[model samples]
Target: MANLYAGIEGGGTHSILVLLNQSGEIVYKGEGPGLNKWLIGLEECVSRIGKMIRRAIDGIHMKSGIPLKSVGLALAGSEHEKSKRELKELMMDKFDWIESVESCTDAQCALSMISKSGAGMLLISGTGSCCQIINPDGVSRQCGGWGNILGDEGSAYWISFKAIKTILNHEDGLETSLHDISYIKEAIHKYFEVEDNTGFMEIFYAKSDARKVAGFCVEVAKGATKVKDGLCLHLFCEAGRYLAKHITAQLSSIDEKILSAPEGLQIVCVGSVFKSWELLQKGFMQVLQEYKSKKNLKNISLLRLNQSVAVGAAFHGARSVDQILPLEYSKNATVFSQIEL
Candidate 1:
């Protein structure tokens, strides 16, 4: 009898679960919230994740009439060994017939999706940002990922941070382009619903809540787009540069061959930033080109999309199950069908 396997990819903003047959094909997939243990609290995160995973499994069973054999969880908060161990325990306690459970940091899952070789560099920019490199020998070098406070350079939070600063500057007459963004003004009015600048100050500045302040990015972006504000475009460009700086910083420390031309190191970009920002993508590519030209290194080739991160988590789950099931089980597994080359 073939056994079932499960994979969960949890990020700062969302979670993805995949159910795979013994073969590489994905039988079921589900998405949910980010299980950041630090932010959501360990118990709450686990409960939310448990519910999502159960939903996916239940959906798969309804479709296929079978239970999962094993579960693999890859998320942002499992960077430490203790965290990974705790996460595994959490899964084992919540799930049944789960012969085994594996937990790893999000970066490991990203690397797995790159290939079974599981060695390469990955740049992730979403609610947060980070760069990870794995050597042929499995030695890893990581840069950035300092969170939103001191780090998270080029992250969505960072972009929003700067955008808000610009807005503040405009309010003070230090900048000019912001007044044109009525959409932004509207979002602020709705969120803080202030009647004027004085009301806005009373709600935002008086309370000094960072998360509340960060919430304004969406309004700013939406408004800028509606008004055709060039300032938003400039913000994205700057976000790209900020992101590139982190990538280059890591690239500088690694061997040139890893970043070289054909057969060079493959950099896989994973996360929301890659999904949403065309300007960011263009700017990142342009900066890489300039860096390669200046350093006389070969151009880098990026492989795989950000969605692969979840695919990778599922793949890892399959691997964990493979350890117990007959090798034939994996032969029938489903590879990602919708992925474009």
Candidate 2:
């Protein structure tokens, strides 16, 4: 029987479900709502995830007669042990045939997407930002990810937060722009179709919503990057530094005696924040280089692109179904195909 594997990359905003075959090719893909149990409650989260998984399974079963053998999920709210256990138990109740079911945080999933050694750092800067370090002994530590209220310094929300403040300051005759981005204000106005202060208020004051404001980072990034806004560039640079600080913090916590990094640590990044942007990545890399040089450490290297996070989950699931392996081990990116979103 040609069994299948399922990977569900669940986040605060959206969830992606992917099915992989024996050769690790994507067979079916589907999407569902987020699995943040804290926000949506445990029952709803599990229900939505179960629905999406079944949909993907049904799609593949009809076309290829593949029975789903295992499922590996990386969910947003599963970072805590209690949440992880809750999600795992709920999922197990629904899916019993899945012999090797495993669940963990989404960052851990992103980590699985890259390295097979299971001992590397993963920096995820999407709507939120966090740096995770996993040593050889399977100990994991995190930096940032304090959510929108307290932390997440080098994330999309942070970038958008600073960009909006600059805009409002400029409107108030504060001239907070870093460079000649006058054209950007016009572009932003056109994009959002805001003609007056009232329009601006409506955009920002639409219930004082953080996500509504943070969502504008995409537009702000385009405009600022196009016009070469110095302030925007500065923000990304700062973001890189802040992210490096977190990475370095994790590095300091690790006992150098056990970890054998003959060369240096390889940091893998995944998320919407780092996808296809020259200025941000450039800024990020530059800061990292400077930081490592000054610290006189082994010097960390970056993989930059972190594709196939969901596919990584699928690979682990498939592996679990096939053999008795370590519950927490990394898988290589080369073993999986591109996870088409």
Residue-by-residue lDDT tens digits, candidate 2, 1-341: 36677788776667788877666667788777756666578899888976787677666555323346778877665678877777778777866655567675555666655556556777777777788877767788888777766787878878777765667787788875655556556655675677854676776556554455556667766665686666666767667667667776776766563233553566677667765345565555565566564444654455654245666666666665563222233334322111111
Model 1 scores a C-alpha lDDT of 0.65
Off by over 4 Å in 1: 62-67, 94-96, 173-227, 255-257, 261-263, 281-286, 293-296, 304-308, 321-341
Clashes in predicted model 1: 12
> Model 2: clashing residue pairs?
none
Write candidate 1's Cα lDDT for 1-341 as tens digits.
Answer: 35567778776677888766666566778889777787677788789876876687677555333456667777876767898888788767865546777775566676666455567787777777888877667777778877676688777777766665566677788877633555455555676666766765655457644445445555555644565566666667777887777767776566554554355556677765554455566566667666765564554555545354555666666667554222222232222211111
Q: Candidate 2: TM-score?
A: 0.78
What are the per-model numbers of colliding residue pairs?
A: 12, 0
